[model samples]
Target: MKTYYKDFLIRDWQPGDRNPAAETISTVLAEYSIIFEPRGADIDVLEIETYYQETGGEFWVIEQEGKVVGTSGYYPVKRGEKSVEIRKMYLLPDVRGNGLGRYLLKELENAIANRGFQEIWIETASVLKEAVNLYERSGYQPTTGIETKRCDRIYIKKI
Candidate 1:
């Protein structure tokens, strides 16, 4: 297995990443539930992927030395509208301490902004304090949560 020690690359998710991407999502959801019980494994993986594939969402991944370290996504909030939402951002446990989280956020933000979206919104969990901090530090502000079965603490950032 490849180990990432220093530099990382953020790029659009491609067909080659599907299996590793699915594994990463499954692993992160399982790990996240250990801290806060939310986002069922099936929902985060299968359901979310079905939704993404249907809606033409763009997915991204962070790779280091041929290993997938993180994943994120950008999709239309509402079709024909200039709004978008960020989804399923995750980083492996070993890579969590470094600044890769913020780096991925900025990279995704820039990618979506370039597509003409005026703003981006993300819904995390109230218990995921580290995620919340990263969002706030990256210019996201708390917003009223959307009524969905998914557990979320919604935040939005204007691009």
Candidate 2:
């Protein structure tokens, strides 16, 4: 599926997108002073589609002039689960505040809802105030009981 937002094209991630997607994510992390630890197992941007597909999920990339600028995806919380978790939602600083994040989120929500998901969850760090604000503005409420050393905030929205 392909979606057009101005000059950007959003579509399901292709095999060739791995490198660019990874680079985009790495760049954002570095900008935020977030360390990339291979042992943490969270830097799997290169295999987004492969990882999400096992659970009937999907990864999408937004590109401009054939270059990846943003990415997001959703996967089931667990096997046969009705709840899904949003992952790898990131965009370059240059593209921020242009409504592209909201667009990407809406598309992910639609895809999750179509797959019969009842709720959507996202984990983020408090350092990312913009993302937290976006989630709050989008009707996601804070939730407890999830503890992660790296990610301190958790939000949930029922669809």
Candidate 3:
């Protein structure tokens, strides 16, 4: 992992990061009884390059002393003209409430804006209360047409 996202030791994802990132997402979702669907909505976690980087998108891994504690990324989508969908942003339970999620979302927006994207979209389940609050507080307006089965809410923010 290469450090480039401020002072938090956040960096782009790598193939070696697959397992730890998956574990972090799984652990976070399991807290709310959400299943980690490797073959469905989460397949992008396992194929970061294909779903993200390969299509003008990017993925990042949050590191704590060389351990993957979180994951964040976005992929270009067909909505809002020059829009991208924010996906796979999950942090270990211990890392919550420390402003990491807010920071990550900000940095992700910066990265997205720097890439010349116009808007950012997100789909999340209601059970992830923290995530739902983060998105709403960060100026992501709730929208319709949720594409993910597990996600009951859809939000969009113009960058």
Candidate 4:
């Protein structure tokens, strides 16, 4: 299924979207001076459905003028668990501050909620201030005890 938001088209990830999605992520990471590591292996967006679909998770891409410009998804933190981790949400610089992030987030949240997920967890780096702000504004609260060297900030929301 595809959703239209102004000139942007949001839809499930397709086979050809992987490269553009990876480029979008790479550009964002480089812009923020962050290095891509094994933890960021999901940059290979084409394989997202392979890893997430069996677990009732999904990967979405946003296109403008037929080019992939944004990506987001969620996956089970553990097999058969009610909790899922939001992953790989990135938008091109030109599209920021226009409410697309919130839109994509709501879509993902609703999809997971319908699939019986009870909680959403997200981890982001301090450098990505806008992302942290977006999550906080969307009702995610800071949670302690979870640690990751790649991402220092962790937030969770119970749905």
Better of 1 and 2 by TM-score: 2
Screening candidate 1 with a backbone cut-off below 3 angstroms (N, C-alpha, C), the clashing residue pairs are none
Per-residue lDDT of model 2, residues 52-156, tens digit only = 877788988899888899888888885224888898899999989889998888989998999889999898988888888999999999987454467889998
- Candidate 3, residues 9-118, lDDT tens digits: the string is 78888889889989999998888999999999899998888999899999999988778888999999997879999999998887778888998899889888998999
Give candidate 1's root-mean-square deviation (CA, Å): 4.4
Candidate 1 residue lDDT tens string, 1-159: 122235877766666787787777668766767332234523433444555556756777778777887888877776234878888788888889788788677777877888788878787776667888999988888887564445567888888
* Model 4 bad stretches (over 4 Å): 38-46, 79-81, 145-147
For model 4, state the Cα shift of residue 25 in Å. Answer: 0.7
Q: How many residue pairs clash in each candidate?
A: 0, 0, 0, 0
For residue 10, give model 1's deviation from the true position in Å. 1.8
TM-score of 3: 0.94
Would you estimate the TM-scores of all the predictions?
0.78, 0.92, 0.94, 0.90
The lDDT leader among the candidates is 3
Q: Pick the candidate with the highest TM-score.
A: 3
Better of 2 and 3 by TM-score: 3
Q: What TM-score, to 2 decimals, does candidate 2 have?
A: 0.92
Per-candidate local distance difference test: 0.71, 0.83, 0.88, 0.82
Comparison by TM-score, 1 against 3, better one: 3
